[model samples]
Target: MNLHSPSSTVADADLQERGGAPATWLPAVAEGLDIRRIFVAFRRRFRLFAAVALAVLLAVILVTLQATPKYTATANVMLDTRKERVSNVEEVLSGLPADSSAVDTEVEILKSRQLAERVVKGLKLEEDPEFNAAVRKPSGVKMLLGGIASLVGAKAPNLPQANSVEAQKLHEEVVDAVLDGLSVKRAGLTYVINVNYESDSPTKAAIIANKFAELYLLEQMEAKFDATQQATTWLNSRLGELRGQVQTDEAAVQQYKIANNLLSASGTNLTEQEISNYNLTLSQARAQVAEDQARLSTARSQLSRGSSGDDVGEALSSPVVQKLREQRAAVSAQVADLQGRYGERHPEMLKAKRQLSDIDTQIQDEIQRIISNLQAKAQVSSQRAAAVSGSLGGARGTLAANSRAMVRLNELQRNADASRTLYESYLNRYKETSTQGGLEQSDARVVSKAKIPTSQSSPKVALNLALGLVLAVGAGIGAVLLAEMLDAGLATAEDVERRLDTSYLGAIPLLASVAEGRTEAPIDYVMAKPLSSFSEAFRNLRTSVLYSRLGEPVKVVAITSALPGEGKTTTSICLARSAALQGAKVLVVDCDLRRRTVNRMLEAEPEIGLLEVLNGEATLEQTITLDAPSGAYILPLSKSNFTPKDVFGSVAMDKLLADLRQRYDLVILDTAPVLPVADTRVLAPKADVVVFLARWRKTPQHAIEAAFRLLSGTGAHVGGVALTQMDMKQQTKYGYGDPGYYYAEYKKYYVS
Candidate 1:
């Protein structure tokens, strides 16, 4: 059994001193996620969700119906990478590069303010009311507001004019309007561009789109033409300068040649030729000198050695020297023969000796003559060699001078050649550019001209309706979640255990009018119809209190709530009558000195009640009243001026409880709300168990928690929280697994 009371051995005085009831067992199923709880939450707040969803859907329908439709036209333009070349000459203004960045740049140019201004001016859009707000008629809403302002003595806002401060503002506004309707984008990974324009008129949209494409190509052509004209002019001036430079350089070359006499014939200088001839003559003369000197030296050497010149090279070659040498040899031979044949003084021998002597003398003289002629030839050859060398040196000096002059000549010639080369190149380029100047062409062309659209592009009814449906659902769900979060009322038995962390004893179904249309108070109705669900609820409450204490029987049960008008007195009366009907001796006590609603509920007019009894002015027998219908005794309170805490917290109140416990099988105390008065707090400790009352779907969770806190502080045994005034009809919608949720389906079990 649940521990809902103090120990049997523990008295009320001891419980009051302890300042809290024994801990009761709480249900373990109170924690964890439960899909049923979420379903019940949404079910309970379905009305709010439906209202929100319908409102949002209605708003969507209205807006979609009123929206203006627009027509869009698109034009395709591609950068012509395969361009036509009219000439081989390169233009000053090159075509746009075929790359993604260049394409993106062109896209931006299409959206440029300058382009937008041109389109607006060309189309005369500034005069059209669609593009110019200043010229447009005021809408109905604006006119209404303006009328109201005039009625209230307010001046109308000034419209923009040509000479006003807002003139530039109006011009910019028109440009912005044009740009706003125009869209330019490059097709993915291609040089193709898409230009689109939207307007109320299909013709206007197509015209604007086509106009933008036409102007873009025109702009490119104009740019190229202007660049080519500038290039031709610059080239003309540069060619003039180059021609003058060439002439000056060539003239300088000729003047330098004349000043230095570096003139040449047949591409060869006269001084150079003379030097060459002199070099050749000098070489031959030296060779002749060397040969003549060698011959003379040989002759002189042979003569010095006393040889007869017969061994000399020149003498050997001479015919006279050969003849003389032969004669000398013959005479010597004759002398030799004569000496051998006769005596030393013989006459033939003397003649032969004289002949030999004559031959020797003539041979020596011939060798001498050969030596003198070699000396003369050597001297003449030496003189000629010296003369040739002198002439060659003179020619070399002249050649050196000419070579020095050639240095300046070569530099001048190189300058003239460079200037002439530059002039010729520029002259050729000028001719090409001048011929191609009239042939400029644009690098872009329109691939597909914009056509007038057959259908409007905006205010799509189907898509808007679908989106509105989704938004409505989302808004409805959000509202349901918000309502659940903000609702703090405890609606079901699960809330008692989960939110308050307390036991859930049972729920008391609210008594509804039957077919007779007769209504009865909860206490009176239960006694009149004991077999009904209303009476059965109290019987169940009585049983829960008795069995909740386990070994300790619950003799005293206090009924209290977080606030007033929670049916605490009714519950107390009904519970007491319920126990009485079960053959248990039951007594009802109204412990509220401030309100004393029990007397009014029971229709008892006792002059002196609990206040008098506690003050010893009236005995229990005199103050207590008996309801003959339920056979239950009531101890009601009358109007009192005394403080409730002083009375309920007194020793007399404790003694009274001890006395009632012995006489009655069960005692029910109807006490004031815990937060409003201290009477319940003081009386709660003296009770065996405290039955906290929470109005179904009425009592806030925080209020119940606060009431329990006060009751526990007084060491009261909180048997459990009982839900009072629960409407069974409406409870089925909650589906919270509470007794009231199934009350209708199981109503046949009870007789009304």
Candidate 2:
């Protein structure tokens, strides 16, 4: 259902060929439009545009050459942006290193009025006449011109400060001079800038520029170093207050420990010593109890034996004779049994009794000794505890003192470490600065400094001369175009054929003027030399009239025109004579009552003319007079009370024209302007032929149209328009200058 492509029909291509793509070739929106056409058009008419450009160029050169030469000397000084080290420490702020913008700031400061005043004082540029001349106002010239122009209304500049006017003037002069001399150019993508000063003297210019850079750098360094010094002073004052605070804290801690009598001092909330000391005291008591049990056991063994650690088992059996015998029997029986195994009172049996006795005695003594030793140890431990408690009290006091001293010392040490770290940091930064500053890392370097230019860059002579030639030629072409576009008269034979649809009779050459003084009548020239242009024009008119309708000729034809001074009278008189020369009856009538130039140019006898006949004061037959035309007839105007319009429009005037038409073979009427009066209006209707006369370069198009409008209103069958007063010089200027220009190569049978 969709068919889309870059394909176009043949019609589209045709349209594009005829007129560029309507969508894409829009004249208004197109960029970089080809103005080549304009240039070419100017080239074809080059003499004009070039001439204009040349004149302007010459005028500028002349003005430039005549102008007084003012020499300018320029001096360059680099606005160095190298930074200076105020301190070693590099600041970290917002995660960025601090970069000083002071150099740029100084550049601006140097441009300020304060610095300008200083320079003025330093250089005394005001005293320099060259400096004053460089910035002089145009008031002197203005005052002179203003005086002359005052007649047409111009006023002088008003100075407001009347009292201190001279002082203000001097101050203004200095300010103006400084501004003129001072110039600055910033480096591309860099901190360096160029300061330039212009003066008549090269040394002065160089001095000013260099001095600004030096002074500004000094000012910047002082400001930054002073700021650093203030910071150091603040830090030192803070350090002193902290030291005093530490000492006071130490003394308070010591006194608290001495008064409380505490064995140990509280640590800084993280030391573990009390638990270790309690466990050590318990171990010492246990060791004393174990030693006492060992000593008591050895003492009991010494006390147990009757014979030096021996015991008697036979004593019970020997007990005093009988008892001793019974006891002895029991003892002997036991001994016998024992001797059976051990052989008669063996030392093992005695040792067993001795061992049992020793064990019993030792147990009793150990219990006593245990009691004594426990009591003694209890007493000794009591005394030792008292001594330990006493010592611990002293230890608490000493520990508190030491702890207090240690805490104060640590605080001071910590502060000292932080300060030392900061000082080291600054030192490191100073080392870095020493390297960087030495390198002078700025982007722009001076290539070549400005010096005094020997010559001004104005006024090119060859260029101006070339322009003048172009301008002159161009002006000539433009004048021709203007003349053509503005031309209103019918200038060519084609105009007659196109407008009238009639044969082009011919054209007439321009008359030099009545003052050029012709001795003979125009007919004499035509008759004497029929081969001449004047005669040829008349002959062509005669033939065209004769052969127009394939008839005998134009008999009793009246000639009239749209206006006067369009050669209607000349045409009329010439036509009549040319016909009369052919032996035809010819009558010339002066119908123009306003101007009787025909009668005047011909020097015809002054008598009652057309108005007299119309007023019934004279008959047309009776008023006919002659001068230049002896064989021909002329009807001149009478000094009638009637106007040209009245007499021409009257029925009587109609009868008179009819009478001439009937009476003569060729009758010609010279009429007034078809626009100004109804004379031509009345005559236009009556005459068989009506010719409109237009003067070259004189008759305006609108005037011609108005004349034609009058004729058309009257329904006059306007024959054609005739061009009069043609000049060959004027014709050549407009490229399509003459009708013959179309056929210059072709040999034309005729030309008007």
Candidate 3:
């Protein structure tokens, strides 16, 4: 709540850490915004807000009326991607939103200086008077000063002649003005941009709008062509390399097959046949070898048993030869294999048996052929191996030679494969690049053409007016608040209470007749509306004075204030008159001996009075005189030959007051302002109540405090203050306009 730190116990951070709620102010603002309260408050200040608003509106309307008419022409523009889509409309913008980064790019282009310059040059507005005036203020000031000196004091010194520069400068100014006048913006999410500009010439408006469109469209086209040209150059370079790579890869594939003797076999057709034939031959040879080993094993067994080992049955007994022998045996494995799955008498089983017989016969024939070939070739190989073994002395030498040849062939194959893979990949990329290079982008096309605009987009008249209104209202309210803040005067009823430190007596309205500009009878309120101001204010004061202590009576009342011009004298006279009207014999005293103004107020006869008696020259009744009204008695200051302080301080003065008190029901004394004179301080010892007056908006606050300090021990009870000259505007600012409110209620009795 406190923006500043207090010197005593409180701290700024502690107050802040109270953790104000974000919405806490809402309830308070809402409560203060009560319809009646807000209305009343506004009504009180209605003159102020209305005055401000009227001034602002009138100023705006006058200025706008005098303003040169500016007609705006606008053109719509839609952006085009400027290139066909690559294969699919969705591909280039795949999963992208409609508001692409490119859209912003175009917006920036429209606002770019390059485009602005183009518009400026096209419009040739730099030479225009209005724009030249705005831009040439510096030069104008120099010219004006020089011209002034030329006229009044001395002949102008010769200045440099710049006719050419001035003409060129004027041309440049025209272009800059055009640029300033133009405004381009994308209206919203749409592809359309609104190109608007303002000009005094209607034909020029349309012309500028059209020119901007042409320039922007041309710029976009040029940009597209430039980008495409660069891309084509790069793509062509890549494409050439790709073409050579693809050819190289094709050649490598062909060459690898020829060198490896795999041309036919590696090809799809021959490869399939070779795979089938190799498997068949390997199966047949394996069967024959197994049969031969089985037969040889049988023969060995026969030989060991002293039977004819050369017998065919011996081949079946040789396990190694038996497998081979069984392939060509009378007993067939094919028949057994089928017999386990099917009945032997079945047609399929019978056919398998016949096929097995044929296979056995073929295997036997093949084994015989191998045996015969081995008999001869094996003899030759053995002879050669024996010969080589004798020279090298190891079989490993022959094995090493064969391993080296095979390793060399495998290395060739690996190299060929690597080259082929590399070449093929390059070729594929080249083809793809070429194909893509030909593809076009579609989908994003300009729906509208770019155009020069004729209207500027800023300094909206309505908006400026609204803003001015707001600013004026703020300034007016601030002025009122500043007035309140700097107020060094009596502020309110509460301030009067605090200064006086006494029970509230009541209040009287400041009248034109009472102060400022005129002097009239103090009983004016009583003569006109006695019940409102005079009768009401006095009756309330009397009741408060009587009931303050809840005592049986109050006989003597004293009136004083912190300073002069607080209306203390006036109040004393009025109080006595009111009491006298109620049939009470009241004696009013001019007890302020040092500054006696009241004695002159009643037009009392200059004769022996209170000072005379206090000096022991005259007795109490001899000095006291009856007033214009018989029920009231006036005791004024006697023209003492000396200062009357000694007289009033004497015991005889006290006896005179006692005697007057018994004669009159009520005695009112008008004393000196407490702070200015010691007489009131001295006389306070005998008074019952001290009535202090604080003139509103006039009496400084510190003066009242000083008054209380001066009269602290005075016998009189400190009575409340009578605030004078209340401000109507203040009542409005503080929301005191309503009848039920305090200001209104008090006004009814005090000011009405």
Candidate 4:
């Protein structure tokens, strides 16, 4: 007898399962997602992707078709800051420098309420049917939302009324709407500005755009004109005041001059001329006095020396005086010679003396005339000096008086000069302003007028459709991934083995009868058609179970699941039949007292089963029935009024399993789900190997883990896990794992 202990098999199977390579779908133990698995997931959930994509595409199409078309027209305005008035005064006083922020300012002005209002008024958009429709006719989407809200007992919003207050409100609303549709942008760094307006009516759009350009230019011209006019008016007023100030200043200067007696003659003041004349005449009189004094001293010296006036400068300078002096000298020499030769009364000496006496008399006459002339000249010089000195004293007094008044006179003159200069400057500015007032020019011009659009600008069909397609595809992929994440079902054998940490025995394909639309009672395909792929899968599972134990062949194998409807009973029946077909004696026992399905699958009519045997009302031999097709013994649980706990807890249940193990080569027990009841837990310790069954793509991974935890807590020997009722075609199509592909690749080998 091959007696296998549950501990030894469990230890060996754990080592074998753990030693196997990690599942390809989950290559790592961390949070890394395998791309291959992701592809499989998406492929498996392709229906969800298709449905989502189709729905999104349909919605996009509907919205695009129902959207209202709009036309846009643009007018170009050249904001030439260089175009300005050619007035130097205007440039200096009122012109602004070229500012970089001017473009942004112009854009804001274009978007301003005033400009919008002007456009509205010019086009009479308030009265246009198209413009009014935007306010009156609500969009379809909004109407639908409103209807939905009404159904939920919400009040719809009220529309504006056509009254004075509401009319004003509506007028403002239209202006705002116009503003909203307007777009103003600078064309690169150039001076050209594009003003675009969109509306339902092409003509209205064009008219509004053109009007905005025209209004902007007109506004600029008006602003410049107003500035020039203001400058002119201020200059005119200032000019009048300056003219009066100039007159007053000149008058004050003249009055100050007259009050101070600061009179002038021929560019020279009166006091200054009199002082010049007095100085000149005084200088000449002093010189004459000095000349007369010198001449009188010289004449008196000549008379005292008895040399007469012959040696004197004045007498010598006279021709008559010089001739008389010569005659006297000759007579003196003759008298001296006669006196020396003869006595005092000699006749020649007497005659010579007489001649000398006569000559001396003539010389005396000449000297007397010279002395008299010198006295007359000296007297005239003294009188002239006295008269000029008195006149100089009067001129010096007048000059002193004029000096005292010059300070105030100078201040008045400076005031007059400043006033005259300022008056002339203002007069020139006023004249320039008056001339430039008529020459003010605008800084912007309409370079291009807006024309009526021939085509709609909104609801770009091709672009919208392409974008919708891209979004739909993205949404579809997103939905698929989300569904894959939310669903934690074990889809493949790898999921059961790797995630649940269990041995993967094999996968049982879904029965062909079910696939072929034959809904009859499920049969053990191993017994019905032993050579089929389904039967072959069970045979493989049987081989794995036998080899699970290292030192001994496995006996008393228990098949169970996390929850009900995992096909545990079907798997157990098929495995038993496969073991029996190998010429091994196998007994299939139905341990689910609550829901007995094995007996139904085998068409067993035995009234006594494991429950009855455990209760001591029947023996194992009496309760067990032999199936004719498979020749396998089946111990069904008949209808009993006993709880699973009561039956599975009995000592007779252990004895019955021990006796069945001795009697059969292999025993298969189909127990209740580990999650729902304690029947599997109670029977698990009695079996040599425990096989956990997970329905393909149906059992949740957490559910299987929980079941394994429960069984492990109870010290049950979990041999391995089996994936049941798998669709091989779908598994291969989605590339779920290696098992499906292996089965597909070797399908022909199993056909014979």
Candidate 5:
């Protein structure tokens, strides 16, 4: 079938547009994953991957074997909210709180340089070579570097020497070393803090860990004790000042009292006492005067009314009046008996009446005397009351004068009381704090003491090996990808068409497979294995060349490559043989006069070759030889160093091609590589179809593109590209996108 017929050409164009070259590349790139491509790339560069992976794994192994094993020991210290209480008094320094923040603070304290220094000094770590750099031996690498530096006369950097410096510097270095090995962290939002230390020796790790815990507790205790002591001292000093103030204020009160004559008696001043006494006395006197005046007025009222003093209460109760009344009663009784016995005007009756009258007079006299006594007592009481009132008035006047002086005294007394209260308060606090100094305790305690570790914590063999394996895999993958990116060669049919933007004719299998242990040239092998894949590929190439253009047939075909050893001569001869076997007359002309590889390939040592024919030394008929196996004509060159300028592009060469085109159905020129020689570039434009050849998986695409660019510049119709030396056995591994992908499965169709 003519591949270049209108229907076939349109079909090819549609196939390519739908899923040919563009499909091969787009699916690999746009989809972002092509497993077959990856497999092929890996297969091609597996050696590089292996080398990188092995090197990385070996380095890891060496480091793991040489590393010094370290042991870790941990001790737990918890922030204790519960502490033993000796007294009800509050502490000068409070205990640590049981919160995450508090635990974090304690963790920081454990990591502090202060505690680290304490541990270093307590454990005498400055003498240990593990911590003291000056005492430690130099490592092998460092010694080698030092030796190199000395040989080169390079001065070492000046660093502080621990032995030469002060003891403080050495201690500081040891502290820093201890801190570096120590890991203090709060255990997951808990009040318990973990104190971990790493060291070469298990015992050393345990000892350091325990030391940190012990020192941390001790630090807490000391801080509390110091705070208590400081509080006690301050209180003691303040108490002394307050005591002096109290004494001074009390003295001032006393002095003010003395100056003001405001001395107190029975919790009151003298004037106040006097005022109270006078108030009582005046009240009593006023009562007495009122009583006396009432008595005196009653007596005078009775006298003015012409009534006897018998109505007076004092007169009525008089003992003499009572006696007179009894005697009068007796007289009256005698008078009544006599009157009854005798008539009127009896002497005894008159005597009895007279006796009663005398008794009554006596009573009157007694009542009047009582009235006089009452009046005298009333006047005496009034005079005594007036005297008491005068004395009370004088005392009240003195009290008013003293009340004005008491104000200043009261202020002084208040000042004294405040000072005394303050002094007592300080004294009490001083006593409490002084007792607290000896009773201080730490806020934290060790919950778990560090024990000597039995197993090493570092240089874990299994873990290191796992990590090494992962790193090796990563490095291998990276190296493979890098090699793929750096490669510029074309391997498959898809690569030729997609990268070069040209038609892909076919892939020619390696000659060895077609020969199949038969000793024959490539052209003879093609003739011997006519049904083989090698011969089939050449027939496909011939069809593509003959039908590349619909209007005119491709009679003159040029076979060339970017570089030598690309199977260009074999392709030319095989293409000619394939056409000749198809019942068409074909001739192959070796245009490379410099190397003359076709003569060697064809075993033709003609005395008259293309050089002789073009230089007019011989005729074309004399120079031409026949490949008897395939019935193809060959015009090979003899071994020579003579190369003429523009020989292939000369008029004689054009005429020879024209004559061959007229006589033969097809004429093929096996030309030199385009990049190395100018013969192929000048000769390629004369052919109707130029088949650019590349070695499968061997020739770089940049070389092919460069050669194609030169050929196109010479106005050559480069029909397509074909890959020679294709490995059929390995081609299946490249997957379905490649031309020889099914070469293995289709081997049953071949007779070879």
Candidate 6:
């Protein structure tokens, strides 16, 4: 006998304490997952992962081998944005810096349809098999779709004929295709650009790439040349207009000069010279007037004092006056000698005095002549000064008029100078532009020409295989996890305790014959093979049932499940046989009236059973059928007129259970499923203990909870739950139950 109670190591109180806070179902599921469990899941599903990886890898290999090979070639062009302008004139066309917008514009130009069409026409790609689909073979996808449509009784669309309109449209299509294959990118942080093209032929790819670079350079040159020509034309027209303006301005300046009388004789203004001469003449006249006034005053003073000749300057300086003075002095000396020699009235003395008188008269005549000359000189000097002063005043008035005329002359001169300056400027620019027009150079040039590639660019074999393997493995793992999450079956004893909030008594291992091969009646096999794993598991279940209640053994136990086909009948029969083997009288009563499986398992056709005994048609002993091999009395369910609810709910049913409990040491009632019918619920309240059976990894958690609710609603004392038909190998593989622990730690102690 393997009688045992719920382990003291994990009592109901211990489980409640360890569970801590009451968690909802989702958290309980999250708590169940751990690194160990993930590892186990991956290990269990590794074959699926490998199969998926193999299939994907094989497909990758096929594609890599059969795919059409394409070749890519690149031509490098250097965009010299730092353009060296050879002239100082403002450029009408200039290169831009390698900013984002400039680079983007360059990229668009390289990818433009016009440029692509030019390339297509130059290469005659409209008739080329590579670029023109009309000339090329149909693609595999198109062929497959065509075949499918044909099988479905539908016709494929025909290709359009290449007429003039269609040819033009086809030409555009070819250009678009070429554009799609072209890629332009700036070589990082530099003015160099890379032009790449893909094609079926390496030589063709190289040819197209080199051609594109050449075309771009030619385009740049043409644009620059055109801009230079336009600038030259405009400058020429402007220069002609400026020349006419300059001539008109000069003529206007000359006309203004003539009208204002601004021209001067002797190349210098006459009014200015006249003003200078008049100023000099006025100064001379004023000096002469002063000299005459001084002379006149001197003469007047001399006349008043009877010494006019002496006071006059000319008289004082005259030689005749000096001679007269000397003669008079000699006469005075003779007169004095005669007076001394002879007395008064001598003839010699009188003659000397007369000589003195003559000398005095001559001196007086010279003085008068000097005075008359001074008067005439003063009159002429006064008249000349007055004439000079009047001329000076007239010259000053003319100078003032000339100064006012100068302002208007200056304005006309400024206009003439500005017009001449502008004409010269335009003329110089026109010359420079004409000289530099034909010498313009493109800012971009081809740095490297594309070469024929030696290897294909597409259908990378190793890379595709590697990627396929990774994706396939990921998908396989995802599928496994999804399947696991969707499954709601109970797999282990821990699941029962965690989900249902009930005690887990023990797990019953599935028999090897039923698990490994075809299905056989397990009740007969357990009796025949007593020492087998199946029998041993049932013995263990019996131990748990016997020790379930604390003070008393569970003598009257009812076995049921949440749903049908959950092994409750098998468990009930096995429990009875296991109890009888422990030297106790046991009775197995089949109370499942709707679908009675106990009689079929027992291999007996009974005339009377529990139904008859409850209806008072047969006694208890008549209803009991003894199984000799297991030493257990069996009461199979018989056909009855009444429904299960009426029979199981009657007072006689309660009395029959009481009497059977008294007679047998253990009365194991095999009841119908709680969720499927009301038989188990009606019978559960009369039993001392109710044991709910849950098929391992098969019964849904909600179904188990519903069954428990149904039984508890009738005040049934549910002792614990037992997991049935568990696969021990799988349990050990997933690390779920005691088998996982025992197989790893104590497998050496048991024979295989």
What TM-score would candidate 3 get against the native?
0.52
Q: Estimate each model's TM-score.
A: 0.64, 0.49, 0.52, 0.61, 0.59, 0.62
Clashes of 3: 45
Off by over 4 Å in 3: 1-50, 79-82, 85-109, 127-176, 190-192, 217-446, 449-503, 509-520, 523-536, 605-622, 639-664, 674-686, 695-716, 723-752
Off by over 4 Å in 2: 1-58, 70-123, 131-163, 173-448, 458-506, 511-524, 541-566, 615-619, 625-631, 640-645, 729-752
Candidate 5 — which residues are off by over 4 angstroms?
Answer: 1-29, 32-69, 78-117, 126-180, 217-445, 513-519, 603-619, 637-644, 648-653, 735-739
In order, the Cα lDDT scores of the candidates are 0.81, 0.54, 0.59, 0.76, 0.80, 0.76
- How high is the lDDT of residue 387 in model 1? 92
Candidate 4 wrong stretches, greater than 4 Å: 1-51, 58-62, 83-85, 88-102, 134-162, 189-191, 219-444, 513-520, 549-552, 603-607, 615-617, 644-656, 742-752
Give residue 310's error in model 4 in angstroms.
99
Candidate 6 residue-wise lDDT, 1-752, digit = tens: 11113462244345346433222123334567555556666666677767776777778788889988888999999877666766676666877666777866887898888788889888888889777887877799978976786565433244333245667888788888898778888888677889998888999999999989988888888888898898889989998898898999899889987997777423337888888988888898899889788977877886788763655677778889878877878888888888999854899888888888887778888777777777788888888888888888877877776577777778888999999999898888788777876666777888999999889888777788788778777777776665555556766666666656677777776766224563566777666656656667788777777777779767898998898998888888887887677778999888888777887777676777777788788898787888898899998877554453488889998788778877989898899888878878888888888888888778876677667656666878787888888777777644443454354455334323
Total clashes in model 5, counting residue pairs 3 or more apart in sequence or in different chains: 0
What is candidate 6's CA lDDT for residue 326? 78
Q: Candidate 5 has what TM-score? A: 0.59
Q: Which candidate tops lDDT?
A: 1
Q: How many clashing pairs per prediction, in order?
A: 1, 11, 45, 0, 0, 3
Error of 6 at 509 (Å): 2.9
Q: Between which residue pairs do clashes occur in model 4?
A: none
| Cα RMSD, model 6 | 30.2
For model 3, residues 1-752, the per-residue Cα lDDT tens digits are 11112331142233235432111112225447555544543554567767766776677667765777676777777764344444532221122135657667666776666876677666655544555653445586788986786575444243334445665676666667676667778867766777766777656766776677777777755554555556556656765666676566556656665765554432244444544555565555555555555545554455578743325452334455556455545446657766898877988788877777676665555445444543454455445544543444333454454344445545665656666666566555444444543333332333444334445434468776787778777766654444443454544454343323344466654555223343556654443445544456666676666665455466777788788888877777777777777787888888877656776676555678776776677777687777655357788886544473455567886887788778888888888888877888777667676667777657775576567666665555665666644444354344232211354335544544
Best of the two (1, 3) by lDDT: 1
